[model samples]
Target chain A: MGRIKLMGLAVSIGKVTERYPFAPVEVPDDYRGKPVIDPGICTGCGACASACPPQAIQVKEEGEFRVVHLFLGRCIFCGRCQDVCPEGAIRLTTEFELATPNHDDLHQFVRLRMVRCVRCGRPFDTYRHLVRSLREVPFIEGERLLLCPECRAKAPLDWLEGGGDGNEG
Target chain B: MGRSTLEGRFRVIDVSPDEVAEVVRELFEDGCYYATGMGVDERPLNGRFAVYHAINCPKRGVYVILRLTAPENRPSVPSITPVLRGAEWAEREAHDMVGVTFENHPNLERLILPEDWPDGVYPLRKDFPYNRKMAGTEGTAGVRGERHDEATMSVPLGPYHPLLHEPEYFELYVREDRIVGADYRGFHVHRGMEKLAESRMTLNQIPFLAERICGICGCTHSAAYCQAVEEAAGVEVPERALYIRSLMLEVERIHSHLLWFGVACHLLGFDSGFMHFWRAREYVMDIAELITGNRKTYGINLVGGVRRDLSGEKIQKTLKLLELAEGESREVIDNVVGMKELIARMEGVGVLRRKDAREIGVVGPVARASGIDTDVRRDHPYAAYGDLDFKVPVYRGCDVLSRFLVRVDETFESFSLVRQILENLPDGEIINEEYSLPYMEFGLGSTEAPRGEDVHMVLTGGENQVYRWHPRAPTYNNLPAVPLMLEGEDVADAPIIIASIDPCFSCTDHVSIVDAGSGRVLWRGPLLEGVERLRR
Candidate 1:
């Protein structure tokens, strides 16, 4: 009798398994899958790199550009990079079919052009990052923003005291 | 008292090495049980190595932690295995991981590390690098089979068996069809997570690392770890966050229990029941994915609170799914209980008496099944468990049937608890990001995992890192009782008896039997097949 009832229940529940490769399964809207970075809005500040638990996201300086690399192989899909992104650039999409034969396919690199300091002639900050900073602090001169943080700090006090020109310095 | 946390719910006491046994014994006499013990290399902090024993005192509703520090030059402490048998594995683990000597500990050999691992180099020490790789010593690997008496035949269950989900070795000494003695050597999948958490992972990042401890009950570990850090840092998590946490934990419990039921049914040769139980479990998984964005490893827990919030729509959907899950789970479990043949297989088999249960310090369904009324959720409530009303179902049968029945009842209880949490969820912020980390402050966080009580101990270090983080999975406490359960039982029932405790080995690995007297391989195949051959 119990077996009869179990058979009835099984008949009612029929099949729960899905044909994954043959059929497309719909994931929820908030499904945490592979995280991708929107290069246009990314400021190359390395917040995601620091916030990532597995150190999957790495930021490195390569001569003229600051490259933010997100390796899919090491990613735990924790979606922490999305949480800590100041610019809301990194987003976790519902695309989780991330298998690949080529090793390079796992790497997602976003390269931002680095701006050289006017005085020191060394790349310091990304151009977009400096521009974004300029928007927040409008009182600071654009020329002052052009100089790297080190060059700006080392500059004399008279340069800031002067109203418009460098003549006073 | 050294320090207290969570409104004096957890108290730390400093004790000298000689008094360790006496103090633990006194606590045991006062109705306390050994939760877990850890050895920490505290030379960077106090120029001494420390050993902490966390004892759960249920009557007082407080966790009493006894701390004993040994000087760096001679790091040794009196072993508490004399007072409590449950402390044996933990003491041996401490010795293996941190190079701390447990004086007078019977059979204090290497427990966690492999035999090939080089001696005198402790991985958990401050001087050791997290990513450092050591060369495996020559010719130290392979089986060190202990020969039993000629009367009893030695049958090995695992290092990998199809019956087991993970890699574990159990040598059962059988006399014809009945078993006399058993021995276990596990920890094949130990990933050195504590070392990684202390060295590389920061405060918030360790939650994800903790979640990876067990694939089935990862959220519980993460929740325990987060609670430990929150207690250490004195972070006040919002009320609504607590409710959501409780909701997710209950969801995890329901799914985990269902999974275990399916496994048990499979072991009992009831494959149809296994399929049905897992089919019902899909609803709970769907609910989890809808809320936490994943079926397992919810990844919702953070240090201050949770990362995700439950919306009204999501809550309604979750409730609908919960209804379906509850109904189907009830239908399946009720059918399973009514089957007399299945009941016969489980009943009067794998008997672990109440006294043995308490002495071994088992927790969760196994302890409850054995008449030990202990649940960390009720005793020392963390998250929203304090606000929720639930009955801890216990059975005195002290057999495999009791364990199954306990889980069945607990599954229904979890369903009701989830409903309560979802309905009464407080409306406010989900996270409280404002908190400060106190350096070198000890905190203990415990959660009643599906298997048993999962404990995580944390010592907050400067620069957003834990100085020493030790997580004791429920299996660590419960695995010791398997040999006792296997003794004097039918050798064919060995797989079900071992599976009855819900040993979550966290990795897959294989088993063979060797002749004890002749030192020859008797059988080398799946444990079930070996059992069949032995029966014939």
Candidate 2:
């Protein structure tokens, strides 16, 4: 009983240590270090919507499943989405190294996508950088952003007036 | 014999460690800043780790690589900490992760690992587990004693105790109000990231891993990894990809320095400057979002080329973001300089004399502020940096204020570089076909991370599996210098002085106490002499 009491005191007083900085830090087991998305398994479900306190989740429904977006800045790193994940698709690892001046960078969700142009039948957006170029104006609000497919086909109307695309001419 | 940079020329020499040490001593005597700590690996043919302890002479740069072998059976080396005071932390880290124990390393406690770890488990060991959470296994960070001094009643700075903004630990050896020694306990946030990159991950997985190294220099980490891998495979990043890499790097620099400025402001108790600095940083983050679909991880960096491109519209938005962010940043900096308390507090505190900084081999803003004119971007041209012409800022004052001024100056340089990369984005593919999953190649990657230079060395091996991989982050190297910087300083100057070294500190706690309660024999904890021999 005395040992137990002392152990309790030590625990409360932060007297114990762990393989910290080595592995398994003095963090809660549920501590969400960074959000990792297995692009292969993620169904793009928007289940993480309410889970995010920062409302960093962004999900766009293409055809069947809703795409999820996460802004790390807004993300409280609660890993509420990982906890709420029905598919068990998201897991939070102890990866807290997320520093950047760009807000868009903090919103990165670990996901994979098949590249396709908006206007053509070709798969030109193999790399996400190409897609990022088109995301400047965003198709929302009728912004003149040139999306992948429309920008390559050389149609002015298909792309937003000024997004990086072939329709600039 | 090798030539010392202090003599005013780039001198390359072929010599052993004995010769190298003599040359280094010669250069140190002449007063040159130790630029950066770099480690590289050569494997398959023969497993050897080549380490570089660089120095920046006033007009010339000093870089020397010493190749050593930490055979899988016996990974150890003679400690240079006795000779080079700056090498204290880096050497300990080299021992911790790579399992290279420096002989006679005065106090070779596990620098990065927490005290409650198991023994013979170097987290950075090439053979160490990356993501494999083997239940009931031990870590090398088995520290036995404490990070505090028994005399002064050691106070652990942070694992998240609030006096600091980052996760770093310092063992303050205090004698009254003054600090006798400050030992850095870091790498608490060790993700086994490099090991993950080398073993389980593909080249494509590196950008993500790179981003995890430090939030402050995400782009630089990814860019350097990309550049190193590309160079190893002899793959040319598309011209557009190069431009994008530059853009990301500059944007990253702007955000990082601004963040530092805010932290500095906060440290000085200047709340208004702190808020304003972050407010300016927000605009930069907005621009980052505008260019990259997601904000921080950009995902723009790929193996061969950038994943993202900038169109004229995005470019225009960039122009707006740059104009707004830079303008706001300028105003905030102006306010910061005008703050009397901040200026006074920072001026002479943490004075790493131009002479001492040169010997310790520090890097980035600290080096520049101390009058060492060496920037990897300028010396070793990688990516688009070869084209851009910017003056490397150097201030003669080797103090906290000098580092602050240097970072502020760098913010402007970053803005200008962004504008340059944006305006002159070449017309070519952002990514090339050569970027096919690199399967078999020995590649080296190095980039100037925000804190300093981040270098990753990779050797492609059998079955898409890396035979050997080595990663060197700026923090792993710079952590050692902090203790030395803290020695002979007052405890009151602790916060700003620590900020001067610019540690990510996310993985370290300042106070380390042995849990005599938890009886698990940590490797670093109790170097019990030949317990195995006793068992036998």
Candidate 3:
């Protein structure tokens, strides 16, 4: 009797299984899949790089350039990068099938121009990062704003000696 | 039971290493199920190591935490397995990871680490580097299990068996057809999660790490972790955030139950039932994807709030999916329950009596299948579960059928819960902006996963990183009950009996086996080979 009912139920809910590759299944609106980074808006500020739990996104300094790399193979698609991106540069698309023939295809890299410190004259952060930071922060302004964190710390000591003339907030 | 006021999440009783057994023995007599034990290397803060044994005294509505301190140089403590049998694996795991030797432990061999892992270098110790790579050859000489007599033959069931989805080695001692004794060795997927959480990741990043602890019950772990940090830092999660967490938890429960039901059907050789259940479960996956943006490991849980919000239309869509899922699930379960062959195989096959269930400290449906009624959601409420109304199904059959029924009932209950949470969804900010994590504070958070209670203990540290983080998955407390259930049962019934516990080996994937006599290496699982390959 139960087997008969089961057969009837199976026939009623006929062909519910999806046929993928041949017929495309509709993904929901909020389906998080592959991460899409808006390179145009990305400032290379390293917020997403730092916020990534798996360290899939990283800012590596290579000689004169700072490269923001996203290793898709290691990415869990948690969207922490999307959540932490201050510039709204990262978003998760509904395209999850990211398996590639080459390992290089798995890596998404963006190279940014390195900005040199004002006092030390050594390359520190990305040029876009420095520019964005200067514009965002109220205290950082003028040429002193272009200084690296180390030089910025010493500039305050220099300001005490100069009676806060040039580097005043 | 001895009464103690609740201090945060647990009623902690500071005891000497000698008194640990006695206190735990008293709690056991007073009807407390042993939850889990954890070891912490507090040498940097207190110059001593600490071992904590957690007790779930739900009858008295309190969690008793047993704390014992050992000198840093000579870290050793008495084993609580003699008094409370469930502490067997947790204690061995503590010994393996933290090197806090359990003095009277019968098999204090390596539980998690490889056989050739260097001595005196405990992974959980503060001095050990998080990313340190250790080199070892394949199948190096390790602790050979107990030597068996001529009467019993030791048969290896895993490390690589078709019955198990993940790698876990179990040495089954048998006389012809009947099974006599069993020994387990797992922990293939340790991944050094705690060490990574402490040394490398910040507080915000640990949730993602917690989510990956188990593929099925990932949200439970992440939610427990977030709640632990919130409790430690005294962050009051917003009402809307709490509601969303509860909603997601129920959604996860629905999908997990469906998945388990499908697997159980497959194990029973009812492939049609399995297929239909899985087909019904896809709707749940669809609902999950609609809400949290991922089918599995829905990473919406953060410390203060959820990352995503549910809109009105999404709620409507989820309700429709829930109805469809519930209807299909009922049809499948009805058919399965009426099937006499499956019922005959399952009923009274693997009977874990109420007394033995409490003694072994089984949790979730396994414990509920027996007469020991306990649900963390009801006993100790977290998130928005307290406000929600639901029934925790309990069965007295003490068999595999009862375990199956408990989950089937739970599926319907979870559906109602999701509907309730969606209908009464609060309107406000999801993330609490004023929440700040403090330094040098401890908090415990437990969420009732689809299997059982998954507890996370967190001690806050400086530089926005956790000092110590311990995640005790439900399978840790439940797996010990397997050998007990396997005893006296037929070898044919071994797979179903083990699967009856809904064992998530990856979540509780640390093991080592023991033979009856003159210990010898009987079998090594795929874990050793995988680790060896990774190193090479």
Q: Which ranges in model 2 have alpha carbons more than 4 Å from their true place?
A: A1-169, B1-64, B70-76, B113-116, B121-153, B161-165, B435-442, B462-465, B487-490, B507-536
Query: How well is each residue in B1-536 modelled by candidate 1, as lDDT tens digits?
Result: 11112556689999987777888889999989999988999897689998889999988989999998999889988899988988998898889889999888987988878898988989889899999999988625645445456666777777664454356788787788688888888877777888888888899999998887877788898999988988888788888888888888889999889988988888888878988988889899899999999888899999878899998999899989988899888888889898898999999899999988888899888999999898988888888888789998989999999999999989999999999998898888888887788999998888999888989999999698989898888888888888899989998788889889987765210011211112121122355444422331
**What DockQ number belongs to candidate 2?**
0.02
Say which docking band candidate 1 falls in: medium
Candidate 2, B1-536: lDDT as tens digits: 11111121123343455555566566667765444443434434467554545444533433343444555566556666676666666676666566666777788877655555556665655555576564444444445324343445454565432333345556566667677766555556555555655666554555655655555566676776666566656676666777778888888888878877777766676654555666678778767767774446555676677765688988997898899898877766775676676788988777776666656666777777777776777765667787886777888887889889888888898899999988888887777644343454545566666677665555556453455555566655456566666777787777778777666654222112211112121111121222121111
Error of 1 at B245 (Å): 0.6
Instruction: Provide the TM-score for each candidate, comma-separated.
Output: 0.93, 0.65, 0.91
Could you give candidate 2's per-residue lDDT for residues A66-161 as a string of tens digits?
Answer: 356776776645455775676677777656668867766676654445445445544433233334444543454223222344454555543334
Per-candidate local distance difference test: 0.84, 0.60, 0.80
TM-score of chain B of 1: 0.93
Worst 10 residues of 1 chain B by lDDT: B508-517
The DockQ-based CAPRI class assigned to model 2 is incorrect
Output the better candidate (2/3) by lDDT: 3
In model 1, how large is the Cα lDDT of residue A97? 93
Q: What is candidate 2's CA lDDT for residue B13?
A: 40
Mind giving the per-residue lDDT tens digits that candidate 3 earns over B410-449? 9999989998999898888888756566787877888899
Rank list by lDDT: 1, 3, 2
* Model 1 score (lDDT): 0.84
RMSD in angstroms, all models?
5.6, 16.0, 6.3
Global fold similarity of model 1 (TM-score): 0.93
